[model samples]
Target: MYAIPDSRLPLPQVLDRFPAGVPHRRNHVNDYLLVPREVDYFNGFLALLGRAQPPLQTDQLATAARNLNDVAAGDTPSPCIQQRIQHAHLLEQLLQDRDWEPSADISRELKLVVAYLHASRQLIPDTVPGVGHLDLAIVIDTAWPKLAAEVANFVDYQRLRHLEAERQGRSDDAIAFNRSSWLELREIEARLHEHQRRVREGSYAPEPFTYFRVH
Candidate 1:
């Protein structure tokens, strides 16, 4: 796990402790495409998650998952609501650790992302009629892709562990990796491969993959 600081990046002295420089308050929702600075901010956030250091909190992930808690709904395809709900579900699965255990470092990053999700005075507040979740969406968009592989691996590991224990007639203390998680992990793997293929065949240069895992 990366040793990203538990405290946010310090404000520039000139900003007088204003939160525009803060991760939760940066208001990246103003632009449809990420501006260069927004890119820098999110990239730094990712790097912080990937840093090989002690985790800040394993329990913090629940905070984010709670925000994503869903109300009863019919099968609707509202992208914004559905998208956030999905993101929340992912966080919830990891937080509950039904499948595999994450190291302290991975938990720390997850905690940070959750904290941002639940911030009351974020870049855009939920009180702002239609556009409130934009900031949350943007933050998730920036952060979740990097975590795709780790989530996938954890799910797979749990599945393998289940098999190993079953074969050896050992106790399976961990919850069995379910069909939904397996499917989600497969989808993540497919998307990652497609991304790599694009980098290989397109104009972009290939970069090494990085995430909060130690291995």
Candidate 2:
């Protein structure tokens, strides 16, 4: 079997969807230009994205995100990784939709993005020894900002729900707890947005990476 299939289209056509939010890192790849295999790999992956399957069901995905949160409790994931997780988590919360309901438009958008996130494989398969998540991360990061208002609205809904619960019991300190969670969510959102701003403005960037032929 072919390790990485050749793209149906010419190279330039394949790159059109990429680097939209993924800045061509100031790394060896861009500096030296990409090798033929690397170029073909991207083309192939971009093509496959059109047919990729969902990576996880909503409940399963929520479990995965919660597990990651538990594992990373008190630690940090680099900004790129963190933003990708947060975006997925926010969508998870929306899909759960237990406490807050989104507008029809927001709900559809969240589901679409979440499905994209769940793709078991991508232009770059996650099974790659390293940097497997790069393609997924870049796609989510590109889509992250557009979802901000909905995410913030969901946080607001959570805050109000907890406050209501507090009034009924008015003793569990649910109010305080929810407030803290909201603060944490907003902080992460702010940081992610700032990071995106810097990337777009060309002010700052996370360390660049070498190419892995996108298989």
**TM-score per candidate, in order?**
0.37, 0.42
Model 1 ranges off by over 4 Å: 1-81, 103-105, 154-215
Query: Which stretch of 10 consecutive residues in model 2 shows the poorest summed lDDT?
Result: 1-10
Instruction: State how far residue 10 of model 1 sits from its true place (Å).
Output: 30
Taken over the whole model, the C-alpha lDDT of each candidate is 0.48, 0.47
TM-score (C-alpha, index-matched) for candidate 1: 0.37
Candidate 2 residue lDDT tens string, 1-215: 10111221111112223323534332221112224454345444433334232322222222223333343434353344455655576677667754345666555556656776676534444443223344455455344445567666666656555655566787433344443455566677689999999778884566577765767
Please provide, for model 1 over 1-215, each residue's C-alpha lDDT reduced to its tens digit, 9 standing for 90 to 100. 31222222221121122223334323232222224454455445645655332221211212222233333133332245446545655665666665555555567767777777666535434543334454455455445546555666655655555655686677656445554555565677689999999877886556567766776
Model 2: colliding residue pairs: 45-123, 55-118, 55-119
C-alpha displacement of 28 in model 2, angstroms?
A: 12
